[model samples]
Target: MARLAMAMQQEKKHQHVEAPDGGWGWVVVVSLFISSALVFGLLRSLGVFFVEFVRYFGESAQAVSWITSIGVAVQQLLSPLGTAACSAYGSRRVVMIGGFLSALGFILASQATTLTHLYLTMGLISGSGWALVFTPTIASVMQYFNKRRSLAMGLGFTGVGLSSFAFSPLFQFLVQLYGWRGALLILGGLSLNIIVSGALIRPLGPTKVIERTKAKSLSDKYRSFFSHTCEYFELSLLLHRGFLTYSLAVTFINAGYFIPYVHLVAHSRLVGFNEFQAAFVISSTGVTDIVGRVVSGWASDLRHMRSLHLLTIWSALVGLFLLLLPLCSTQGNYVGLQLVSMAYGFCAGALTPLVFSVVPEIVGKERMVGALGLLQLIESFGGLLGAPLSGWLRDLSGSYILSFVVAGGFLIMGSIIITTLPHFCSCTNPPPLSPKDTKNEFTEEERLKQVLSLDSTENIHNTDRIPETLLSQNHITLEEIPLSAKRTDDDADC
Candidate 1:
């Protein structure tokens, strides 16, 4: 069992799929860009439909809010399943199926007659598709880059900002031309493009062989499947202290992170801004969001500081801006609100890529897919409650002021939590892997060659004089060698 474990670890250590840092990675980045836009970019713009749903269905704000909240929550909660599927099937097939599901949801949603229908179609179905599309795409991008990972993530996610800028007004225009139902049909068509993007995702690592056996009982097959899933999903990561703390911090951030995207338009209208003006506010923020992502990505790649430091600063600023957003409505000051919203947009965008980028640093790239999936799954609680909580506050108080304040508080709490991460105060980059960490880095073939060369040497009499470093490199302790393999002086004389 120990040998088997060591062999598996050695395979991971020696044959790591080296990040190209560029090359076909650039293509993966492009696919990430497209999928991100269709998924989150479209999601961010869905606020344009918030008022329409409220008025059309005559539902309370809190009730209508559940539509988006359910979708967000469902997408996040199912993320682990998506990553698991990516691990079993290739990412390409899983993502393509997800794309189809996403489009099917929208197309089916067009004929909905009730909010429940919307919840089932848009919230459940499309959200499931999003679950499959996001984690794998992000994981693929991470695998294809090393030093420039932050920048690649930033560039890929720029699609969200750009589409947010474009999709808001475009959605409004579509809603104006065709009722909400007709607009959904068009959106469904747009979602089909996610299928094409899925096709562009090339696997970064060699495919693992699917274990198989002769006929077995049904229970045996089920047990085997569960065992395979547990190994592939890296379920033990749940016990990792650093990962848990990081996930907790991110969950708090998630609680506040999406409040604006879901409510900013409604808040604008409440402050006496017209629909176009409200839409423009979100669109303008999207523009700054793009700038922030690019700038943050470029600066992170410069290696002047830790990505955690940048994330901490941006998270704090994002909370600060969220707090200030409510103040902009004191006298219905559109300009002030818009400017504050843009600032919030920039901070939000800057921190997003860092959120994913820092995971590799925290857990190492080998566990990225599982880490991302688990992170999303844990944070889904925040996403599940955030918007609806904000909406309930709005309903209770008849204003969004308290809601924004509470949202900001969640972000601030997240920022404080981030300060406790291991090595946050370090002044220098982390040291390279120690010998203990790299015990399996040497290849089996190299160890065999070294053994043969040592045996061929005429002057060497025994393994006692073998270099400790060489033994350590080969992950073999002196005590583990058999007595029969070690030559005795008496035997040598004979």
Candidate 2:
């Protein structure tokens, strides 16, 4: 008990303090809104360049698919590094550097003479920027709000929809006015605004700067370095059941999540829609997507249902719509395609905020950054394979029907996996603070009892009761025990 309390006191010195839940958080949200517009919003709109890339490069769809896939892969695969950077330097510095890298990648890609050049410049370089930008920005937002977290996330992500609504057609126009190369150059210029967004992130709590201390030996120095790295990245989360299950479920969801963004425009053209018509289809969905995000955020904050429940419902709807996309195309119904795409857009947008909001539920707010880093690291595989597989299916079948079907399958599988989350089957949404407070109390009591039991073999299984005499002898009090014991039995005592 004394050790736990001592550890808790030491932890407070370096903790990533929770957000005040308001005030400058709104400014951070505005920053998030802009960052989302640049990152994901631009990503989804890049599909406007897909067919152009195929025609210009004369590469197979599968080969061309590697462009976006590699970018998404690198972004996710390197997220742990980004989080570590944020822990060492503040998120502001790391994100600004990311913005510069992102713009540089786009500018360099403007000069690409071959597909491999695109892969290196756009895929790796631009992806590295995204890796730096994404996890830190989301973690910043989570640090800012609590009860209103869903709404805050929803409002922030609406930038994706807002940008998509404008960017799809705007990108197509840029392509026509100047070639794809020129268009990419202009994108590089626009991405510089992300640096401004990064500038706006005033970290809500303690500055994340780590204090350096001299070590007695080289081995001690290495051990201290490893310890700091583990602490900053929360490597312990790897052993957490709830976090692991959530990561796996999100991985499957991610496998299907981006198919529409990457392929929908191309599929529209394949179904005989003209260029503007196809662009409009994406733009229209973007409008609905905005509505969905705002509504989802508002609804989630109502606290009438668990965020996990809302996420499952949204995931299922998104999968159902993905399945419908192919059906509408097979029937040669452009109107049906547009409507189904809009429906898919709404459900997908609605789920975005919930995706981040649910993290605090799985892991407490203090661990949000590391948990997000690990989650992105694990889910990167899905992001890596999703689009390329869809493109490959398109090449083999000469249509996108099977691609949509397979993507939907992945989403449905994700929905099923999420049902395995702890407390997912519970009927009522427990008041947030009550359960946490009660659980903390229960855990410390039980842990102290176990220690007492361990001290005396006669009381081995008598964990339900703590002898008062032993407590007096040990100079322990229940109130003095640290609530850090509020972790699952599967967790390490530390």
Candidate 3:
């Protein structure tokens, strides 16, 4: 009893210290920047190699399209497992193991003579590795900051755009110089840098301090397993109205999101643009995409603006710009295509960071690990099939025009759905605070901070909504904890 009490007290003391949001957290941001570069950069630019595979394998367009789709599917599908592993083990161990697997998969892929062999090595193995690295790294960024979370994520994710710009031309050059196999070998070497990124992951969230205890009976063990699984997966978040609607919007947004990345260059080629001009359109998108991410993030942080409104605006614009792609193709001017590409890129980049940033607000950050995992798990289906859907449309229509239109339609639908967020859903919730009450008002983040400031036993049951005072003495898991623990008893504790 004495030892357990002391351990609990120490744990309480440690969590009270606010996250060092700007200090070593910046180092984690840098690490995530490199990671986003490698993961998204590679995924985005795989189109440069799409033509080569079609030529060499004599495969149909849809058949060739499944290669990248399978990788994306595997990456998104396994995000829950990645979160569970990060929860059980530390982020560093899982990510380093992931890095090794990624490198090994690519190295093996470089020697593959069959498409199935590419699917297994490159799609399954390397994609699973990406899951392990991506889930925990982004979760850590959300955990490490409150006020500046969007800005931090914006800075970190800018790597994707910057890297997409560099890698498109670089992969084209590598393919020109040494063939696809040589390019895969060099990329295999580059994927190992995730190990260095993994090294920089320092666990930043709530501390899990276990007491010395004995094993349990069979029934008890099974119960423990189920409990831990729920904790890891956060199935309870399905109960939150805000989270459900936002996740649904994400599903639609994701259904349309990656189409341009996968098909824009090929679309340019179909429109009579030369190799450099086609790649240049993608590169221009990358540059403005970087600018949009930073600017949108900074805007979302302003006093009166709601992040959801900004998110809705950006998503609507992503769809509108994608709809303009076919029109740009019709124009057949290099500068016109580049301008349209930049417009599409800017909106897409603007919404990407807000996608993750708004989740902590929807569900309290306390339940984020499971909520985020589930969000990705559900969104994986969209990521998996969106490209193939485009390819299938391409085969039928004999042009990429119909495909871009379908993609744009889904994004526009997503924009409509996000307007149902809490701030807009009901008459009760106000849109913004006046400058006078803003200081006195408590945002959800502040409310959570106040709850966490309580002693651990008391804090456990009061995560949501503001509490007038601590009202319970019991320590329980999140599933059992109420939004407020208000009680009638005044002197229940000594």
lDDT digits (tens) for residues 1-494 of candidate 1: 34433433443443345677899989999999999999999999999999999999999999988888888888999999888788767688888999998898899999999999999889999999999999889988887778899999999999999999999999999999998999999999999999999999888544433311211221122223333454456554565667889999999999999999999999999989899999998899899999999999999999998999999999999999999999986788988998999999999999999999998677655567788999999999999899999999999999999999999999999999988988778955556444454343323323443433433342212333332222212234335542212211111000
Q: Model 2: per-residue lDDT, tens digit, 1-494?
A: 45434433443434434456789989889988998899899988989999999999999988888899898889899898898788667789889999999999999999999999999988999999988898889888877777798999999999999999999999999999999999999999999999999999886434434322211121122223434455566665665678899999999999999988899999999988899999988898899999999999999999898889999999998998998888876656888988999999999999988988898777665567788888999999999999999999999999999999999999989999999998899866434444445455334434544433433333312322323222212123345442232322111100
Q: Which residue runs does candidate 3 get wrong by more than 4 Å?
A: 1-7, 205-222, 425-494
Clashes of each: 0, 0, 0
What's the true lDDT of residue 74 in model 3? 86
Clashing pairs in 1: none
Off by over 4 Å in 1: 1-15, 210-226, 432-494
The true-versus-predicted C-alpha distance at residue 113 of model 3, in Å, is: 1.7
Query: Each model's RMSD to truth, in Å?
Result: 10.5, 7.3, 8.0
After TM-score superposition, the amount by which residue 473's alpha carbon in candidate 3 deviates from its true location, in angstroms, is 15
Name the better of 2 and 3 by lDDT: 2
State TM-scores per candidate.
0.84, 0.85, 0.84
